[model samples]
Target: MLFADDPGFPGLPDDFIQRGPAGIEAAAAALEHGKPIADIQQFACLPPFRRAGKILCVGLNFAAHAKEAGMATPDYPTVFARFNSGLVGHGQPLIRPRSSDQFDYESELAFIIGRRARYVSEESALDHVAGYSILNDGSIRDVQLRTPQWTIGKNFDGTGGFGPDFITADELPPGCEGLRMQGRHNGDVVQDTSLSDMIFGVKKLVAILSAAMTLEPGDVVATGTPSGVGLSFKPPRFLKPGDIFEVEIEKIGVLRNPVVAEA
Candidate 1:
């Protein structure tokens, strides 16, 4: 069930996305009562929420990625936070910050939390997930590797571009292992990997995170990206001004952005 956040009813036009949790339930209940649902394709895809309370992300969750970067797999998830200001629409532009020598991409699968959770068990952690979306956790490589802290490199404004729309939990197939995550710049593939390579997976990350901090409804958690980033390429294939970034995930969808210098 796709839920769009369009605020107006607008005569229930075909494909009109139902807004709000109540609106989504009402639409489902209406279908049970034999009422029509606006055509699926007619509804415009909207972000899972206007703004998430927190955007938490995991680092080096993929074994291959750790190996590629010559770091040992973390004994525990390496967590970090990104400011909401970094967020951009799925099709939006990613304005590169000035004074940064290197910019790179990290394609990740991000999930939304539906309920407030604290110290949840790993076995039951997935129950809190509302849905999934595609997120490009774009980073500034030079700054990230320069300091022990990765935040300054990964959380710049317009770096967290995501969403064509959210794919509700019920709608997505279980066992995310085989999902394909690919990134391209100017029509050339740069990063390609499978979700199966993730070392921690969603369950463990969520359980561990919730145990440390409360995860509220609409909160976001990105599972981490695989290897093949520009930083890893020979001579380093960093993004330049006016470059197009296209990130695609098999089911969740694709998010495309153009690179531009900060104004």
Candidate 2:
């Protein structure tokens, strides 16, 4: 589906589906004749894609992140799921649940699937990607570590920060390689690294994931964060109410949010 705000196209629906290659072509054509939307930063941005079938996430995909966590790099990606309910848009508040004060930030690149594919090979995996965006996989550390499974802590309402904009795959280098990414707390840089540093790049991740199940359109795959998460610090530095966090990717733009206490 596509959401556009071109003044010339006065009757354009706020939400609509654009299917397959033809739909993409039509959207591109419309964009060529449309005027740019203004003052977007003042609006509450939604996740770049809505109604995502699955929100697949990878953990420790960066070697530095693994090292900082005192773990060996796994031969396979460590995958998890974050439901849509956990996601909040750019400029929205990320609630720190009252149960824990260990809220942490993880800066990640999120890829949205454009087409359905199963058993796809790494070489052709890029064909299935619609675009890329930013994600802050916020976690409540104490709860996340209480059990081997990380879902509970990771799935708390309003923990995930997504969007700002979705940049088409064609606008970026294939598989988004070599791009720089960083996580900033308030105004200070906390996590920074090159996308190339990821142990499992986009293509490899898609191939591996598709091998197990069909990747459907609008599904989101978060490539994982770098080192410098709160847990890796000498004294853990968890997020607190009034704190602001930003996740920036070289070309995809920034996903920013403010921390707030869960009411």
Candidate 3:
């Protein structure tokens, strides 16, 4: 979606999924023949798409991340929720909250569900995916570890970096497997791993999550991050003002954001 005065699909409603996959295909065809859309750099990016509902996140789905965090890789995926208010799009700033100085970054691949699904099986879970995007699951380390529950630390306003664009599933391999995932801090490569390293892949996550609740179109599921978060460092290098963080997933695209202290 192009971010402009009006923002998003010109003729359609802001919620692109109202018309479903066929609508997206039609929009693609129109864009090919119609006048060009503005270059993304010309405008402020919003999350590849907006989901007014659930934003489910997976934790420690990467073995290395679990190891670095000093937690056992769970038999089931570690799940958490992030409010939409916490997210900003490409070129936006990730606010380092004043409540905590231990801000951290987790690079992850997130997928949007295109269809309503409940009690789905792993074999059919991928069918629910409409598209995929990148997310910097930004965290406030101190608050995140304050209690057994992580929602508070994770939901800090403007901390989550989401999107540049949503790449439809057709443009990616099934379940987005084998892709490379990387995170950079101020242009320095800090985290790098293969999507294959994820302990619970997309299909399994979908199956597990859907069994518990319905996943609707536009609902997002972030599939967790590989190691190299700020908190994983020996001295714990937390994010500070002026820091630029990036999350890049091969085939999906890159999500870049600058860090700014909360005013």
Candidate 4:
């Protein structure tokens, strides 16, 4: 099944992803049958879970990134919220708001929850993940640092770049470890690291986050990016109009977006 309108898809309702592993199994079975979604490229690629209930993010989860930001690694996860208006799909433009010139790029791993989880333990946290995707945590640095809470700067319309494809959790290594994540700007590789460098792994994140809130199916979490953000550079190379940034994660795919100045 490819399109949202694939009603004939077996074993799931319209919001199939919310159905968890059963939904994935249905789709995988179709794929195995060589029933590839025809003319898929003719459609625009949106976030696989476009109607996600909550979009959560982590900051300072990568020790190197925390050090680069001149901040200490926190005892607890640095959690944040990203509203719907802030994110755009792959190939969409990432708007650099006129409010500030510190538009920057961050390439990171993101995952979708597949089960209801509240106060779940790390041992069972990964079982709740349905699939994983790539997220470009585009940033407006000046405004982001202006406040203790980064809500405003991070929530500008069309800044967060997400999607391309969502890979089933079974396809990737447990906790998405050993995968390499790369952030390329205008075809030049800027940020590079192993997913293993994450100070807080996926299981740890899911467990910690679920303790504070009930993580529902279809909720997405953009795991924090590593070091090499523009803010840490000597001259601070921020994104501008006409620039293109690409986030490529091993085994998943690349999520590429161009930079555009806000009208």
Question: Number of the top candidate by TM-score?
Answer: 3
Error of 3 at 56 (Å): 0.2
lDDT of 4 by residue, 15-118 (tens): 77766777777767755645556653344466656677899999998898999899999888888889877888888889999888899888989998989899
At residue 250, give the lDDT of candidate 2: 98
Candidate 1 structure quality by residue, lDDT tens digits, 1-263:
32234333321211213243444455455545453545433433334454677889899988878888889999999988886787787556787889785888888899877666799988788777767888888898888888888988887888767776667677775535578889888999877888877888877878889988998777889899888878887898888788988888887777887888888
- Model 3: pairs clashing at backbone N, Cα or C within 3 Å: none
What TM-score should be assigned to candidate 2? 0.92
Candidate 3, residues 152-226: lDDT per residue as tens digits?
999999999998878889999898899998899999999999998889999999999998999888889999988
So what's the TM-score on candidate 1? 0.84
Lowest lDDT 10-residue stretch of candidate 2? 9-18
Ten contiguous residues minimizing lDDT sum, candidate 4: 5-14
Candidate 1 Cα errors over 4 Å, as ranges: 1-24, 27-48
Name every residue pair that clashes in candidate 2: none
Q: Looking at model 3, which ten-residue stretch has the lowest summed lDDT?
A: 1-10
TM-score of each: 0.84, 0.92, 0.93, 0.92
lDDT of 2 by residue, 171-226 (tens): 99999999999899998999999999999999999999999998987789999999
